[model samples]
Target: MAIKDTSETVDNKLEDKELDKTDLASVTNGAILGRDLTPEEDRRILRKANLHLLPIMAFAYLFQFLDKTALSYTAILGLREDLHLKGEEYGWASAIYYFGYLVATYPIAGVLLVRFPIAKVIAITMFIWGAILMFTALCRNAKDLLTTRFFLGMAETAIAPGLSMIVAMWYKRSEQPLRQGAWFLGNTSAGILGGLVSYGFGHLHLLWGFDDSCFHHGSNLSPRHVRDDRFLTKDGRAQAVARVETNMTGIKNDKWKREQVMEALCDPNAWLLAVAYLASIIPNNGLLTGLGFSVLKTLLINILPSVFQLVFVLISVIGSTYLPNTRLLFMALNVVVSIVGAVMVREVDPVHKWTRVMGCALGVAFTANFPMTMAMVSSNFAGFTKKTTVSAMVFIAYCAGNIIGPHLFFPSEAPGYKSGFLAVMICLAISAVLCIVLRFYLILENKKRDDAGDAIEVPLEGINLSDKTDREIPQFRYIY
Candidate 1:
């Protein structure tokens, strides 16, 4: 198909009748301007673009999750016994992984994602971390395992946030929740895959198997090789490029604006979201890895939660796609369920082991809000640097929570970590409240934007390729 001449197509529309910023709010949710996108044309470009984007993203993320969670799998597969891990050393090992991620993500995103193509950067990191995963096989002691895990964490740190920026680059704000759900599904997929892999370790030793390390070939998914722009005729390239330009997201804006960073820092919503994220992760991060090893201590039971979570993830994605503004609603609801699950896991009597196990499964279903939050980050934030900065901050919180999470479950707690459960319950309660607060705050902000008359006295012509901050752009509307 030929590239749709968005410039010419839009020129006539702009000249005939311009869309005011009031309509820009509609545009923020993926409305088309004039007749620039016929129904058929819109579907065609979107199908083509998503066809190009989703598969690689899912595959890369699958391995990223699998590689990270492989450490957890190793727990059931004899890692602790093999490494002679006593008490808090395993906790330290778990915590150190995110510690590496915490320190690495900021500089990597600031320097690398801003400068080079994100696909290249993702590829480089995937390979490096895969090598690190392979290196994990060589660790003979707890110290060696800790070192390897830390570097592996560092290698994988930028991936989720970087991919968030990439999805924003390609898809509109409205479609992001669905697309983000599609990619983030990889985490669930990894959980399932890790379960199966751990099962393999239980039955047939999977160590050093050629295919065991899916990371070796995960890097082969270079965008050039997959969604090759070269294969697209000149017209197609123009259409694709115009879509990005229209989206007001440039592929590369070399200069990092200080004001954008400052705006992100000043944005209270960013902090609220970050804190909510941190709270949500603490219950689920470190303890999640040990659930199977601790409770049932059986390989099949360990893998079962992932299966249930995969179902939950799919259900949440479909719910978001159909329901529109109910993302936060589902988030709060999921956390409430998770809190019930936490209590069950902590307090179930010996006769009700199965009930407790079911509760544990339900509690970890809090993955619902993550895709929503990532989509929120992309939809709400404008300006490349500001968005990136916010993305970085979110990951910083993610890293911190994951890092601190393991420590909450002390070795003293053994099979039932009461303190850990209580801590998670409190954080999750806080997160649930924050979810409502964030939703209300955005609703108020949107109402105020409507009152302000959503018209930019002077809007930019095509795209804000200059990377203007959302605060600088009065016409911009933040999406909930």
Candidate 2:
């Protein structure tokens, strides 16, 4: 397919006729734009757009997560020993990144989204974080690791919100779940990817110059081979490692300034969605940061370790993406899984570990919420400004959750983080309630509009929700 610039396409359409600014308002809802195409054509447009958009957002998130989580894997490989990190220092370093993320997330959503081209903004941020990830290999201690993580968080703050804004601009309400699911699958994919990468790195530690004390291939090998081994210089090997790392730094582009991005923050719906996102995010981040440690320290010793973690990651990705009635069902299932996981953590049996893993996997179901909410906001809001504002708000909530999640990991609850599990359970339960409330609210609003004779016919034309000047089609009610 031809890669046509969307902005240029819009410009060409405008030049074809003396553009009617007023007419733009008339079709803000499904009214006029819906009328312009047949149902099949409309489906085709939305489907194609989603197919293109979701993968981009998902992959962007996948790499963003890989960079963020790399620290955890590194820590397992003597990052702490190498850097002289102390107890709770790892927790603090991990938590600090979210602080940077939280500070930047709302600002980008509220300001930069309006003034900048999202694609350019996101691409630039991605490149910056990738560079930071590569630099992390050079860190000598906790302080350096913390600083790099903070900057990494800052660079990634644009991703969830920016992608939400972009998705909103393209798809309607009914089509949101699957598209959103696709984007959220990035998180699940990250879990699987992180594990695999860590496993590879752990294995690499046994090679010629890579051996760290935690992993020694020589000790496991035949005595003759162990004695014969004469390793290369650490400094020489480190230089080669540095060179390889530097080459992995990704691309960079121009960034949008603060003022230009804030326009998306002003919408009220943005705030509502942010609140909803916060409801889910608290548990999600908490689980992600600690789950690996829990599996390694507790479960890996007793079970077929690969099967346990692999199952959790697989269930998370598949259940979230392909589950029926994704929005409500997934949230409901997450609540059950979290509660069970929390309960199982306190048990003594090996089967209990499986329960905890299942609970963790269920947490993955929350991924559906991100995409669904984005689609809802996009379809309901009119005009570029309003849409962008709400998009920013959604991300602000995402950042809030990330910040709140890690704090639940208290030192008092180490080994088996009982308190954090309970806290996450509460978060997931709250998400379920919110989903129900939003669903009913949309239903009532639709009914009221239908009664008022302002109901929009499907296959509408020219109407968009963001266009405020357009006549209110009384039937146009907000879909829950």
Candidate 3:
């Protein structure tokens, strides 16, 4: 726990022939070295980190969600008509975004995020996407819309992986779920904001276009203008690094390890998490529902699900922090709720409108599970390369699910979209089962590590802060 004592521990291990010199040499030179913080100082550092970091991330995430789902709101305001969208062209437009997302996730996450300064990379991507959002206003046809959305998808891919890594860098393993949920609230709450924005600007033609173009332009530029070290002092940065030492997940490491990438590809937990993500996102795409009502009623109705999602996400993630080893448990429960909601939406009579509206609200409850899975990635993965690689794999599955989601909503099905709803039920069920499977897998892994008599104390001696993957760190424990 003492940074000064860490050198003595390293020296003793070296003299005892217990520590490899290569491991010492491979540690990043940028690693923050400092004294152990007081409990009060730890809390103070956390508060400062949260205040400075979370708001910027949350704001950027809000705009990202808003711009991405703008097509949904705009479709209601005649985006289809404006672009002269044909039968399945609108669905293709929605699906195409993920095609770009799927294409770009690997290089950006596995390479770009690793090779560059994290904050600067995030800022540049946000600015590029914001400009793409502006160009969206100028699109005269479906082709232009698809082109812009593709690049927009590519640009916006940085936020989730980057922010998750930031959380992993700054927060403790126990603190990650709440922090991840906090920023992700931007995504859920964007529904309410998008509703209000669409309602206010729907009737106005040029103003709506201008708002989309200029608002994003202004918001995205703010990050680049801000200094990177504005919040933390020199000593505070070291304490911040010291804070997450027990996490067993190292911070930034510029040198990419090919073996780590291969390990990530072979990791059962990574594939399990990826499958859960794939299942959840397929249903997420079909959650938006509307009745044939006035704009005000439609706005109010649409806002209901966002409200539902917000409440559920808060309850689940906040609850995870207090309850030990229940992150995946809560995730499964969220998916179960969505399955029940999907059933209600599919089975309830069309005449029972309010009931179906409530069903629609419940149908999206599973959105809460996403942040938990992200929390798993942040808390569970160790090596920076493996973490980013696993994240890219999971997001690739996410993109694939999203790409397939819209196409499931056959135009012939119209308002019912029975096939899409059916797919939602199936995917939700699969996701719930996978959550339980992942939980059990982690439990078994932890048991094996314990039974093998790994040196749980070695991690305390500074080994945890090394650029070693979880597989190489026998002392590392998985958080379920």
Candidate 4:
């Protein structure tokens, strides 16, 4: 009988040393996964790896945001009147999706994500959600729409946390921010593309002159339409594992550890990140999802804030790359900008419509905190189970924030939702304070660890060979 390592392998993969056959096997099988893969060869192969990996993530995230926010567009287009939604009913519709998201995220991460092939889980969920999105266009009433949307949120609950885990799996720590940025650019990309798509949906017609079906068809077709063929098979997979061994990125923590779970739960900084997420999502999701009800024109509503958001996301991601210890700094600056925008929204004259638009856009721009915070998650934690637990915890905060966010913009607060904007500013302020405290905690911990033999950065091979959690490693420095 084959050993479990070989017996359980889905692709029947062979190690690099085992592939020390002829030169033809190395050439035909893969580029990076061969034996004794060199650094220069690794760099060459990384380009190929990114090509295979990044676009798949970017596309999924792009459409996920687009589909998730499609209801906001539909709100302005006539979803409420058609469905006979009264008062805060639409807010409930918006908020309910996150409830399903909250319920499903942890179980899925613990069970499906931890126990199965990640790429397969991601792809299957994308397909499942795509099908759910199609059912959205067929809903006849609030109940039907809510049913489809709640399931949609449940399926999508896997992507963000799953993507974060995959990022750690594939890239080195330093490469993570930019790669995450590139995929996360899909957020702003969704803003720009989704806004334009939504605008087009409202104004234009397609397929025998029925325009509304476009959203239904578009959401379904877009995901299923583009198939990612990068997943390897047979010996190709063996070569990929060779490349992975070069990074030692696949060290397993398969056995359950009660202590790891306890450590994750007890950490104060974990609570701080969760609180920050809870507070931040309230305002950001409120502004992002329900902005249609404001005085802004539909075209501008779709486009302008996204323009600001796109620029800021790009800037912050790039800035984080060059500026050391600047994640908290950029987060603080975003909060300042958001607070100013809130003040602008409150104090500005009603007649100056664009000024108010600018204020809202500035407020929405604070979404850069998302990528920054997630980067914090990936860089700060280690070990499979612990990191998954942290991701589940933070996203629960995410679901709570989003669930509460919509309700803050009641029908009573129409046109100028003073209370809504004020609440967001307060949330941003709270998040900013949390960022500082988290940074300070990280700094203090690094100082305490410095006395041990943790000075120089150790190779991934060293770390992975031991399968040490960040908590277990004396030298594991938390990235700010």
Candidate 5:
């Protein structure tokens, strides 16, 4: 006879004054049948959400990556000459985009996502970014390019964190790695697809025009297609919310908690993850292009690395899903592979260009580390505000690294940016070490909880979805 919330209770809790605004209304109201889901029922619901959610997520993310990297592609195809860019102007243009991204991530996440529906915010931002990308086509000088790139960065910043939040909302911890990686393959797809598109346009001497059009068109496509509500019946929506209850991380919470912001800022684990992100992203800043290689060879060289990264990301995420407690371990291993790849790029004789290209492909192994870390945040962090804050901080680190990363490729270095490659190798090593440290820290924290008799497993109904931080929940165990 116990009352519970499910399909019948949808929107009923919105009028309850006693209920915390931070609680998801569909979850806290009481009106539906009370029962635990069977294993088969759980799988059915998961599959449905995956089908409806992931494709749109992946497609949106693919366009985001392409839009962000369009400048780099155009640079190789005469953007520098056409814009009259000089010395470090090109690097500044690249770095300035991230400056807008860094400036916008925290405030935008804190304000817009909390006040508006997440899907709506994402959709609107997508439209804005698409318009901004179209504007990139009209940039006739370095100042114009810099101005357009900055606004584009601000517009696009919402997508990555927004997508991460969506993954946490719909999926469980066990499902997060693969789902996160699946969407992130947008980055890999952009690389491969962008290279092919750029290669085709390069032959026609129309690379910049096509890059702008592709970015704009791709951005505009995602807003109308996100059918999140239509994916499931009313009953299926309840089941989707119910299945993730054991996560103890509530779906969507509008009310911000100042204490949770401080918690996220002070958490040692958050900083560790931030450092890992910072080190890993520095290497992603620049790629060798158009140093005298034919457009065909340049296309091959650009695409080969993305293909290799695609393979490595798939293997790593799948391995994380099937293997127990191997998420951080695999992340560290990929970073090591990247280190070896960086060394190969730096030390290999220039005459052996293909060998260096192979190294470049291997250098991207660390790409998998990012989704792994995002999964860790989704699995480990509780409370919507805290989780969002942590995500913003990590991305700020990401933006900072990207900003600093391009400048490391000194214009004087020309074909072989030895200094830049060396920096890449060092940062990759640091990231690998930090991943190991984080794993140990999580292990120790879990052990302490177990010793304190606070690690008891709870049923789905027994778990608190009241927007508590992981630290406040003694039963919460940190997952590596």
Candidate 6:
């Protein structure tokens, strides 16, 4: 055989190591299954990881959204009448939850991840919020409602940031957009589920044998009620009503302590992400929070209410799931949709105008920005501690936008929320510019690393980072 240089042998070994690192595992017998792996193999792995991870995160967010937006659905029933709420009382009730969320978000991100397991913390928080949501039915007055909403906010503050941290731990930068899109599709799904649940709950008072008073209409009375009725000299209906009220005040115990969520607040990256989140989320909240409901209400007059809601849900689902390049695409789409929708508001007697407006709003406002923001924060930060901190900061900004959203629902802009829509359009434009800038910044950072000869090294399985000398491995650069 011809003699090969030692240098050539060393280069061949390095190439072999890289190739081994890039192969996928086989299902049976724990073997390396694939052959001749390429860049496309790396992409496939990323896509599979995203597919597995995004659905889990999306389902988690679906429950979070249900817990958060349950109030909006509840408001459609007799809650306002029963609670005797006044002007802006509903808005305040909705906004106050975000205030509680804001107070807790950073703390959860910075401190909690360091102290507790992520899954445990997230599950506990989810259970707490779910309990809070179930308790909302028991709220007797505006004060009680506000208190409940505030606590609900507090319980939910951990989920968004915590999930972002999880994503960062598992994924690379280029893999974020599609994963983020999948997660945000949950929001769209939540809308559909919320509307259906709301419509069903709204009709609960009409269930079989139930009177308009939401009581079973049997003349027969129980022994306890009958006994109480004799003393009051009337039927036992009032006593039965009292018993129902007592039974409905479900469990009200606090599941998580303040100290448990303190880690999320301590990071610098959290603050940076918060700035980005604030820029992106303000307009999103403005359009989706109150404007969506208002548009639905107005369009019910000319359009079939079912058609309008169906269209809204469909648009939201498709826009959220399908959008590529989540950060830039969502922001750009939002601005264009808002401007077009606003202009369309002036169209007299256009068929399905409400549907058009809703489709645009769902595409622009409700879909992509949320997921992208979370993904961006996750991609930028690393380790559980720093990731949690950044995630919390992003959500804190999200809370600010939530607070600001309802304020845009001015009484003066009733029927047609022109000013609010226009304002959101401007905000969307600003966010689009910021996203582009951030993209460029990331690109520059990656380029600098490449220039320094620090490109990512693909390590073989069981290779330890500590064992690999700097000269032996290429640097892993972040994707912009």
Once fitted onto the true fold, the runs of candidate 2 whose alpha carbons sit more than 4 angstroms away are 1-35, 38-54, 202-272, 287-333, 346-352, 455-461, 469-475
What is the lDDT for 425 in model 4? 78
Q: Which stretches of candidate 1 lie over 4 Å from their true place?
A: 1-35, 202-221, 224-231, 243-251, 286-297, 454-456
Residue 204 alpha-carbon offset, candidate 3, angstroms: 10
Cα-based TM-score, every candidate:
0.86, 0.68, 0.90, 0.81, 0.90, 0.64
lDDT of 2 by residue, 275-394 (tens): 766887776554333333453443232223223333443454355445533444444455455555545553434344555555555445455455566655555654444455566566
Candidate 3 residue lDDT tens string, 1-480: 544634555554446432333334322222333345789879988998787778877877877788788888778777898889997788888888888888899899888888776777777777677677777888899899899889988987888888888888788999999999999998877888878868877632233334434444433433221113456665665566667777778766666779889999999999999999899888767634444466556765778899999999998889999998899999999989988988887787767778888888888888887788889999999988899999999889889988877767775776666887898889888998999999999999989999989444344545545667888888888998
Which residue pairs in candidate 1 collide?
Answer: 3-235, 22-454
Report the poorest 10 consecutive residues by lDDT, candidate 2: 244-253
lDDT of 6: 0.49
Clashing pairs in 5: none
RMSD of each: 5.6, 14.4, 3.9, 7.0, 3.8, 16.9
lDDT of 6 by residue, 357-396 (tens): 5544433443345665666555554333334545666677
Worst-scoring 10-residue span by lDDT in model 3: 219-228
> Which pairs clash in the backbone of model 4?
33-243
> Candidate 1 lDDT, tens digit per residue, 69-176?
766667766778988999778778877888888888877875677656667778777767867777788788988988988898899876787778777866776788
Scored by lDDT, model 1 comes in at 0.69
**Per-residue lDDT of model 4, residues 1-480, tens digit only:** 121232323132233222212222322333232245557655754676577667767766777787687787777667898888876677778888898898898888655676655565666677677677767777778898778878988988877877777776666666667777778877788777756666555521111113222322332222210111244444444434455443332323444455666888998767887787677667756443334344235644767777887777878878987887788778777777888888887778666666777888888756777877777777777766677778889889888888777666655776677887777778888988887888898888878787665464554422332334677666577777
lDDT of candidate 5 over 59-134, digit per residue (tens):
7888778788777777777889988999778888888899899889988765567555677677777777767777
- Residue 65 miss distance in model 6 (angstroms): 0.9
Model 3 segments more than 4 A misplaced: 1-35, 203-228, 287-290, 455-459
Report the alpha-carbon TM-score of model 5 versus the true structure.
0.90
Per model, how many backbone clashes are there?
2, 39, 0, 1, 0, 17
